[model samples]
Target: MKDFPSCFGENGVQIADSSSSSSSSSSSISKAAQNLVTCVYQCKLRGRLSFIVLTWTKHLMGQGLSLQIQNSTSQSLCKVDIKPWLFSKKKGSKIFEIESSKMEIHWDLTNAKFGCGPEPEEGFFVAVVFDRELIFFVGDSPSEKIAAVSAAAAVFVARREHVFGKKLYSAKAQFSEKGETHNVSIECDTSGGLKEPSLVIRIDSKTAMQIKRLKWKFRGNDTIVVDGIPVQVMWDVHNWLFGNSAMSSAVFMFQTHKSSGSHSQSSVLNSSSSSSSSSSSYCQQQIKDSKLQGLDFSLILYAWRNE
Candidate 1:
């Protein structure tokens, strides 16, 4: 497995290849693995920059959750894992000592409602308190019992999720912090031999981008406008077309690029014909470098094809 720092580089964007062995193995896991989602949030702990990672997983037995607090250097300050079968431990709190400061984590999942994914769709809250002050919290609604305290809000930095489908894969994404969540779908027909394979991406059911010759452009980047903001859409589908196993998956990344404009879009589209290796590296560098400027949001989707 890739280290947390390497997966989420200095800019808070994932840097590994989507089609690598690590990604493939992760995608090939059991059906329960499809319920996994990892989200990274940036916030302040004791006035110092830190990250809070929440990983949600689902198993045959039940839903599982893990939380980790890391400093600017990606060093773990505190880690908590909630076992899936521990139904009685749904509502609880834990305290940890970090550099002489006390950090408290409280969670209430007894009334949590879950959808197809492991993450609760509503009716739950996870709160983090540092030095007796509320630092971060996430959920549909906060309980009246947990007092509301004023503090710096956490920034949603990045999310990595696994999606499964045969020809159409869909997920929800928000390009900006305050942006509206939109339905993002990817469609490609590689099953039939009669017609040439092509790729199509849609936002809110409208076609945002399309690639005519997917075989030649299996791994490339394109610029698509979302919420009037320029987003760089990079995809790697080499495994879908040529992998030996049916479980191989394709990887897609949707990133908001504040610096990208209309002029650069045409240039990037023209350069899509470059070799896959160079194109993949160039796209990775583009995201890695963009993160240094504090890009708000990035979404990585591993689309697994079901046989």
Candidate 2:
């Protein structure tokens, strides 16, 4: 059997379309901790495009990482898992082969630092070398050494995140490769009873956007400015309003665009994208393509309710 790549694999949690099987989502969300996060980076190697998924896991055991590299066709190329129980080491390296190419991945976090989340905050380094060329390097490692090892072959392109909260969900996001990362949060309280529900999103403690009467507007899109850049924000809250206990979630996509006149318009509701058919490959393709080139960077969020 071939090992397929999934964000939920290493964590022992596999999430499905809440709109279809709300019970499963509810059970899985209840078992999930709050400090876990997954990041997917679109990269280029030898003129070919691919994605690198880095999942940071945090539990009673400790902090670890799960990495999956896949080609543009969504086929899994390689996967590296650093499980806490099996290795008990703070830092190490792994080697693997892809189509007969010798590839090496190295990391050093013996003296690494971390914040409240599973992701490292400082004192860490991760490098990827292929056939003696440094394809990618991230951390405090000397920049000159990286350039000397090999020419730059990989670039951080896009990312995705999974956030959980009962009323407020937060995450750090960089709208551009060179943009400053800001603290962003989404606040919503649907316990309106007989009144209208409200949705508020803030970046760096500054209000960037707000939606009133979210119950009536369960699915839609709009433009919001974060750090002075126009970002198209699309949302689907059907599950929040009417999902079974297991299906209580809201999906949001914040896409940063380059053109100024390209956004700030109301979007037609697209139910087919996040409908019960969300498990379909077509839906997954649409979700991934939401970024790419003209669309630039995107922050996809799946906010789960604890209630």
Candidate 3:
């Protein structure tokens, strides 16, 4: 079946709308650790985000883990200070800020849903593209949590369709130790099973993201540039978001945009287009996925200010 791209195949996701809250009991690393242990038991019972503190010894402490979030609100949101609950000394804890208007922060420390298996070596990353700017952030994460993050990133990338139209921007995930720069690409395709749409993503050019059924747009052999980068993408509409009998292919493109002054160069290749009958099948699939998923996973509906 066309599965969710392993990385970020399409750009949108159906997230359970959650509220925002904080936890700050304050004791020490031990307290945080105990809290981390206790909080896992409470995840399914609570709504909104939660935090858990981890400790090394009965006295010494480490830090607090909080749920990461991406706020697409039009208002300029500021960084929240949860350091007081995490550190004993004024400078004990540090708050890292993601520069993008849409950013991700550590959400929690427990992996209750995925079950515990050596902690899963998780790190959190969020990718956001605004206008000409694209930014992604990485923090210590576990495998289970990373899966959640990958799911979120796929949703974020899918939303680009509504903003840019025809899958204008794609999103990818990255990982790091000391927090530095990295290069990643978001790929969207629809050439697999005929049941559910999957999302696939790639990490550091190796791992494939789990994404399915993107709004396929450009046929392979199309080259585009974005933020000075070059990307060659292939698109399949019959399997993206619209469904099998729709009128359009779920548009799937890479991060880079078509180089300026190069439209004439691609005129011939661009001239060949899919027929209305082909689009009909694709649109049917897109609608089917939307009905099953129950969210506007189709980026086309939300990419612009007025979609």
Q: Which candidate achieves the best TM-score against the true structure?
A: 1
Compose the digit string of candidate 1's lDDT tens values, residues 1-307. 1111223535342322223444445344535447778888888776777888888888777888888888777778898889788454888889999879888888989889998788998889898888877888998666664566655568877788878889999999989877899999999887868899899999999999999778777776777888888887877777687777757567787877666456234223322455434434655665675566445577878788887
lDDT by residue (186-280, candidate 3, tens digit) is: 44433446655333434355543333323332222233332333333334444334443322224343332223333212311121454343532
Prediction 3 global C-alpha lDDT: 0.28
Model 3 is weakest, by summed lDDT over 10 consecutive residues, at 37-46
Instruction: Give the winner by lDDT: 1 or 3.
Output: 1
Q: Would you list the C-alpha lDDT of every candidate in the order shown?
A: 0.74, 0.64, 0.28
Which portions of model 2 show Cα errors greater than 4 Å?
1-25, 141-148, 151-153, 268-293
TM-score of each: 0.86, 0.80, 0.21
Tell me the lDDT of model 2 at 231: 85
What is the lDDT, from 0 to 100, of the residue 299 in candidate 2?
69
What are the per-model numbers of colliding residue pairs?
0, 1, 106
C-alpha root-mean-square deviation, each candidate: 3.6, 5.8, 20.4
Backbone steric clashes in candidate 3, count: 106
lDDT of 3 at 7: 17
Ranking by TM-score: 1, 2, 3
lDDT head-to-head 1 vs 2, winner: 1
